[model samples]
Target chain A: MTTVPVRPPLVRSSDRIIAGVCAGLAEHLGWPVRMVRIGMAVAALAGGAGLVFYGWLWIMVPTADESAKRNARRPASPIAPAVSIAPAVSMPPNQSAAVGPSLWSDAYSPGYPSGPVAPPLGGPAAAGPVGYSSAANPAPSGPYVAGAPSQAEGTAAVPGTGAWFRVRNMRYGKEILLGAGLLLVAAILIARLLGVEVPLGTLIPAAAILGGAAIAWMQLDETRRAGLVDKTKADQAGGWARLAAGLALVVAGVLVMVSGSGSWEQTWLALLASVAVLGGVALVLLPWGLKFWRDLETERAGRVRETERAEIAAHLHDSVLQTLALIQRRAANEHDVVRLARAQERELRGWLFRDPARDAGQLSDRIKAAAAEVEDGLGNAVDVVSVGDTAMTDRHEALVQASREAMLNASRHGGGPVSVYLEVSDGGAEVFVKDRGSGFELHTVPADRLGVRESIIGRMKRHGGSAEINSSPDGTEVRLKLPAAAEDNGEGKS
Target chain B: MSTPALDGTAGDPGRTVRVVIVDDHAIFRSGLKADLDPRIEVVGEAGTVEQAIEVIGRTRPEVVLLDVHLPGGLGGGGREVIAGSAALRGTTKFLALSVSDAAEDVVAVIRAGARGYVTKTISGAEITDAVYRVAGGDAVFSPRLAGFVLDAFGTAPADIADDELDKLSARELEVMRLIARGYSYKEVAKELFISIKTVETHVSAVLRKLQLSSRHELTKWAAERRLL
Candidate 1:
């Protein structure tokens, strides 16, 4: 659904002629009377006389909201005469019956025999629900439709009228140019009447205004058909670019004001004063605009982060946690099961560890400290060896944590006195934790056991590695394998 | 290929189950095919998702024995091969094979729709057994995994009693059970994997858990409770 772009309505404070501007703007925006009056006063003073022109322009423009309301209150009048609507005959039935584009059809009839005049669509006190009908031949039957087609056939029909035709961008461009030219001519005539000398320089200001209008028109045209920016990037683009353009314009306007005034000393003083005031305003606005721009960028980043987090969380819950819960629920003895459970616990912690951007030194130190903590927490009479020369990257932390989890599991679950050997190979790192204990027959493990799921195995898998256990009744051996870092050749060579 | 002899049950429709093998190793697949009952039909074989999808589409086997590490392993590992195999997501039940019985690897395959997970070290008969169980929607895992699972799920609460404060230790526990069950002094030693004197010490602790006065009462209580 393409909606016509409407400017924000504000009361016109520069309305010295009457209170009509304030009343019209308030009606357009549906603002309260008191608020509209206050806004007119505040904006006229704060937004400068230039913004006062903006407010006045908004007051003069007929708001679409008002047109919509008026359209609702109008009587349901059929097309004045069906017979005169002959030109619509060649069109498809579906197109002929579809809704008209504008309130013009309901408000005033261009086909009326008496000639087009604004109808009292919405009187001051509009009571009751307004009925809206989209039927194409809605004007009442009379000479209006019958006689109207004959006259319009010889003359040009208004675009977006009757059955077809729409006011395209080209038409809009011409209308804007016509309106701006009229305004320029009016200003020139007014200056002549006031006995002010018309100079070549005077025309320059009008020409600049025309140039600004052309640029603004092109922008609106581009946005109308194809959005000027992606929806996510839209806010930032507007804020940053507008801020830069506004600052440049302020500088250019000051330069123009100075050169336009001929008295060197007076112009210099006036220009300095204006620059100081405008510069202060620009300074205040720059920060506010930049803040808005940054917020837009941050919002986009936040959305990406949230999506990634959800994916990670779902993976953890559906796969890893379920296994741990199963194991913990079915383990036969406290002594027999505690090791796997502890391994799973360590594994869960490792998977949950988030590495923020930090210096290599800080990250490695943190991992080393974490390793020491794991050792202290599990007091096993086992030989523990650490072999890795690479400074910790985020990836390395994940691998280290997985090995630590396996060690924890071996110490706690795999029966017997244990020993851990960490070795870095040419292409990968391997950590082996062996325990002398009774091993079970092959191919009888349960699927949902958590110790295997969460602690030793889960961590390794998450780090893109693997863990294997080789055990018989006499003993058990657990090995963890991880991808070796390029710099870890020194450590892994052994 | 000529059908191998031995277990003619493979050709019996009642015993035969349609199977699709998804391992990368042709040798392993051929070996599995050779040893299995002739009743079990090798419906289709594939080594990768594209091949798997093609074979599965044509054969639509009821069961798939998927290796956790295949050529072009998804995510560059075994678990990824299991979890990210979109070709095996529906219709067919999978039995995962891996050298690693790591809990995460097992969970990954299970979550990927494998009905069971077994280590590659499993014997041929056990693998055959697993296939049947997975086909029947019953789960199977290696013995180590079974112990892992059972221990994980079946932690018995430590039984503590008010009389346990009597300072009778674990040694006394062994002795009490043997004495209550009418075991002779030397016999109790063999049962406990300990010396007869150690069994005697544990019997005292067992007596203390009950706060019982005599062997006669302890034996009667143990007999009544069926602990003997």
Candidate 2:
């Protein structure tokens, strides 16, 4: 039996300190906030590798509201934001902050601080978030304010813009080498504080290993649509494997930091070896990285294409469209000339205004394509409109054919432009072919008119559909109705 | 602004109707203006949303032939031009003219305050008559516009122009259905056995309902924003 996952999504908590790195990590790993904090502090004191990891997580881990937005089905109750804190333990950091008295004080806080902190790396981190979260949120067991930052504070961050989803991937990245200068400063400051001669050679390898682990750590959570219920598996072995690989990197990094020597050549080799290890990790994540890159490239290409299209439109407006206006003005008294120019103008406008990638299979496209054929052959202008669309049914061909015939009948008899209105929904698809022609009596039409009877009515009836004709002196409208596919009804039940 | 060809006084049945043509293509605008009825005057012309607003403000034309897609004002196009002319809305009506039947674009403009929508393929005389009717403060529904009103209000989901925005009255539905069936306004009046003026009032009322309640409008506005 499948059970709902109670585990919180790995998002940086709304309540946080510094950048909420430790709090988010503690939250995801099910450890006391203080323990993760101490681990980070010790790592920081050792070689400043922790700050690089912290900085990376700060940039990568989405804040609480973003997490809530991504996995709407995580819970409606806002419980997912309650990252790390037990009623009996580690909330002393929050207690010390003196903000809102408890988690319940915040409007979106779904969990009352209770139960054990849970298993895994339990203790030492949850310290600083209590301070900043007090500004954005309110600390548990502190005086609550009526109007704190709350949800807005967490969601206010502007995500990166421009070529956000690129399609081109660099299998071997340039190695941005972020935080090297900061790593040096942090190392020197800590080395002096601890009164130990810091071995500068080992710093590079430790930083590389830590950076590599953080790179893999960023992929822990899945990104989904803004507002949809996601009910995927509670946990995947892949996630565990990544997490295990990350911890091994941390252990190996610390060991190298402890044992690394001061020789320049050996330090260079260690750096290369650590990079090789990272390359192996990157190889494991090649597919995911490739897809991510492709999205960014695709978005960038779409933007460039849009600019090019606008340029083409501007050029066309100056040339061909200007010429058409002359034709239109000169042909003002000529009905056919005016119609032809207007038709050409419409074609140009459609090309310029059509969406870059309109789905050809949509009912509107089908309706317009059929209408165009009639316009070209019969010299009758047709207005096609489709309001909403649905999945194509087995009866779709019958529906389109009947509509085409109706258009033909209207354009031929009416000697005027016809209007085709299509509405496709779960219930079914309905097409209305309206013509500005004089009335017709269905019975009086004489059975010799096989165009209406055999082509439209008969076709529809054979395909489990129906057709009705509404005729009056002003005009006539042929209505066609096709039921949605039989396969969809059962699928819709759940 | 173009001067009226024939100097006719206002309030006369045969008087000239001042109009604004707000289309992106200057060629199409001139073509349409050239083909219009002699009784209808092209008082103003604009090829973009900003220009439309400025020209409409300066000329105060009786009816504006608005294009649904144009080059300015947040890509709202005709909708934005109409929104920018909120002050002139009572005196100046909008009749949306589009080359395509993109439902969202048509519905968005209608919700923003277009009195009616007609495809660009409409004849010059029909557009001329439409202007005169709109000038007389009538909602001119081309057959396709009526069909759009029916489908959008009749049976789409909440996200796509369903009942939450506004539900049409039975009388309005009958009127729209008849129009969709290609009945002229006079014919619809006769079929419903009501006065022509009353029919106009009902059509205008349906438009008001589409963008009436702030509550109903918010959902639709949010949906439109999301789509864009």
Candidate 3:
């Protein structure tokens, strides 16, 4: 008895067809499999109930191994009955010990067990209380005469125990109601078309009322299902309900107008009234519906954009900015410094403006190229040293341009061996262009001389960075700092 | 490169002003050396801060033509040369020469004890006369640079109170400027020689202190305060 309570009903593995419902049930109940199949076929022929019941049982019942697996996974609830009905007749030795306490409890318990009482009837009557109580009490429990009295008494009280209400609250309740309503409407329509004088006025109104009631009930059910305590979500769902109600009203109005038979003027008047009602409802609700939909769309789009921005920011922070900072700190000479600056600029520009992605070639190679260019033009020795790698290829062009200008300044003005150092770090990159020549005054450069102004300072400014020229009689060192990330557009001026 | 002949017609070697060209680039040095009038004698040249100090100290020239931004120091550039070679402040007049025309650069070297600041674009004759004037103990700034020196060292009252900026530490202020300028946390850390985590901490502290929400707001605040 305890074993039966623990295990769910199992489908027989050695089945004929359609999941072996009749066979599995016959074996479980100790009935002849042929007799059960013949009864099922007779019920199915009478209507579709037996087929539907078989399909439902096929889906609900697990195989022996599956039942065992489910039992192992599921913990028994304290309120569940200790004795199961099947084992009482099938396995007698275990029955008495398990059945004793459960039989006593069943006789006294207020709420009768609903699970084991409904499977015997092979039609729509399975859901009906009359069939459940009558069939469950009389036949199977007869073998255990002592236990039969308590079992029969327990099942007898089940119908009045609000069992139907419990069933109605199940997740599929709305679907079942919708299917029934549609079937009812189809049946009525078919009956009318077959020349039966059906009352359209009452029937159509009744259908509309039923649909509206179902929608309202479903909305409330869904609200409870979602566990949304907040009013806003409930209100949103209510908006949907209102929209449904408006549609149902329009449908009801059309049905009434179609079913009416009167003078031409009277019919025209009725049509006008129906149209005005629909227009009024549409006028009142359409803007609100559109606004609600638009708000939801904008909110979703905003969330997506924000997430994308955060992702981009995190990527840049980890890779590009870090490398640029390192480069800024370690760069050794004008050429290498310029190259790093260029690379940094390009990276920033690309990031801010959403330019096409570029391959971040080796930082060392870029520095070398910058050094080579400077060395060629200035006829000066430039040493390049760089450490680390970064995949930031945004504003490199502007940085490189500024760096070239700084190098040009060094070669043209400072006039000696220039050393270019490239330092990349976590935050930004710095390029130091050092010249072993005379340093001059920054403020003394003529306004018309745009090399330092436009090429170095202006370019850096445009790229959202700064250029610092530290010059003295000892030597001039131009330090270019390019941040890893920058705003897309420059602020008017700094 | 062969050194060009200094014009002998200007003055005798003994009576000429002994000047040392302290530029880092050799080509410019040689060109300046060749172009200088005979009155201003090119005695020595040095590329970096250490070399500049050593060369200027050894020659003890009347005037040292200093490049504003010299390398080979602890990132101090030309200012370090002036600060390091403080011993020759009165004896040898230091005239700064560079391509930068930023007022901050001009003021920095001047504050470091340079006699004058001049851009490298000056004609060779003008530089020679400027060197002569500097050597003679007269301040010799380029025409445009004179305004920068005055503005930097001016006695005018500040347009805005410093109280707001005084709320932050130097490091915090540095971080704030970078953040306000749209530098990422990592970039700020690199610029300040700190960790990204530290940069984040500083940024948070700045935002908290300023009662601002984000970097965007901070930038707007800084711009409004003219801190950028």
Candidate 4:
């Protein structure tokens, strides 16, 4: 039987309080809105005066009202600014803050909120609502807004440029940690107001535990999003085990917190011991999680390799096989056919097998920008433009990279002015990199040219895609086509 | 006008062979058709497997020359072409024609019951030759396919060895030959008036000493060796 990925709700531990469980349980049980609050109160009462655990729950889980408001406001609010500015700035819907709601939703889940009220630890100023292509809201400083016309503002984001640092920035993990710390503080303050004993030592250890866990949670969250589909039953089981262990550690920490030393001063030592125990559990669980993650990654890598192999096989079937098959059918001169067949066979037999990597930038901005970067790098006069609104995907990125690589090669090896055009059609997207450079005949080049294989054709073929290089003394035109992912039949053919 | 009268009902005359052509490009079918003599009628042409199936059901050509890559089809769609057709068993023939001459493709297509496997680069003459061959009884594999065909059909036997059975002395070999020619071990025992176990031991020894893997292999070896 196929197992669905179980996304469990967060549970409070003395170590950390992530409101995720209340939300998850709320979601799972289809409970009425206030059920989590009632459940928390009952749990606190049952667990004996609920001093530590109640505080943990209060801090860990977000208020149900907030979650409901966030959910309701999601589709309506965050997208307005991005959508309004999209046409004006010429930014695609994909690259813009159209994803704001989802990103914010994930970030601001009760367990980890990066709102103004719950700043990440060290309290970096929260990113204000951003405008596209504005001076202050340049690609670096501003949230990516889909369909926002970005002209010179986008130029700064080219790699190696001063503005490029913003594009390369990856601080979401840190932001999540800070959010967790803020939640813990808020929880402790609330507990004090509720007339609970506030011990510095207990707070310190609890804070430490929370801080480390929040950091790990953020990184793990990123990793999970990156490619952590449970490809196998064993890995799925590992995920379940990790969740169990995390839950267990949290429970143990709570037990220590509620046990409350004979006096308020001793509470600090208890908190420290509790933290050490929880931290030790997490540390022990770390290797297992990593092991499962690595296994999943390896399985993914293997799948990708298999896909590449299948692609090459298909390409060979298409190019070399078809070419030879054509020659076989039409060759009037048997000797010529034999010679051509042999030559083709040798070429195919030579590179028959191949072994086979990210990321968001709008299709247009990325293509033109990539073209400009290559042109700048190679000192070649090049013109790059997008023909239409292209939905961004790794395949499109690959096509652009291929075109850029081709342009670079033409400029360096072939040597001259290059023209790049990015067009999106119903079939797929194509990046045509043409150059009036010192063009080499296809036969003159070595059979296995790195640029031709890796930068041009290899990238396209990885996605069940295709490419063609036509060159004479006049110029070279590299037509790179990335097949639509929806068109991906999920397996390699040849 | 003497057209060679298509007289013989080769096999299952009532059944129509369902075929699906799975090339991403369309131009190939016409060219392949022209090069391939008019003997085999074209049924349906699909740029991908989905279309191939729709066409297969519609036209139901006896043989499908499936391409490895058709844009929106499953990977290894050559397999899909064969396996998808419910009527493939003992009825339809699949001929995989693609640009790849990889050993894997050859193995895959064959495993998928492509009676014939050839690359897209195969000459029109050879393709016609392949079509006719597949239309007949024999499987038409490309010259490059020789290795794969050998590998697919000639795996090492897993069970008992003939040589081990051959451990019996020369007398046992004679007894085994007699048993193989329809003399049961009991009959041999009765005829030779030896105990059944002794006969059994001799037969077992003979089978072991022959270095054969199975009784079938021993028979085959004996037949090939002309001992039978």
Best by lDDT: 2
Chain B TM-score for the candidates in order: 0.54, 0.82, 0.60, 0.56
Please give each candidate's TM-score: 0.25, 0.51, 0.24, 0.30
lDDT of 2: 0.63
Q: For model 3 chain A, where is the 10-residue window of minimal lDDT? A: A118-127
Ranking by DockQ: 2, 3, 1, 4
- Runs in model 1 deviating more than 4 A are A1-247, A250-259, A262-494, B1-17, B23-41, B47-54, B67-92, B97-113, B118-126, B142-228
Interface RMSD of 3: 18.4
lDDT of each residue in B61-89, candidate 3, tens digit only: 88888888777878677888878778877
How well does model 4 score by local distance difference test? 0.50
Docking model 4 quality class:
incorrect
lDDT of 4 by residue, A399-479 (tens): 777877887877677554455655454556666666655566766668777778776777778867899987755557677
DockQ-derived CAPRI band for the predicted complex in model 3: incorrect
Score each candidate by Cα lDDT.
0.48, 0.63, 0.55, 0.50
Candidate 4: residue A285 Cα off by (Å):
26
Q: Per-prediction DockQ scores?
A: 0.01, 0.09, 0.02, 0.01
All-Cα superposition RMSD per candidate: 31.0, 23.6, 32.0, 25.8
* Top TM-score model: 2
Candidate 1 lDDT tens digits, A300-386: 565445434433433343224433443444566554244334344444433344233423453324434444444435534343333
Where in model 4 is the C-alpha error above 4 Å?
A: A1-352, A355-494, B1-22, B37-44, B48-64, B68-76, B83-93, B153-228
lDDT of 2 by residue, B113-160 (tens): 887777776666567767777777767776666666766575432343
Runs in model 3 lying further than 4 Å from the true structure: A1-494, B1-14, B150-228
Candidate order by decreasing lDDT? 2, 3, 4, 1
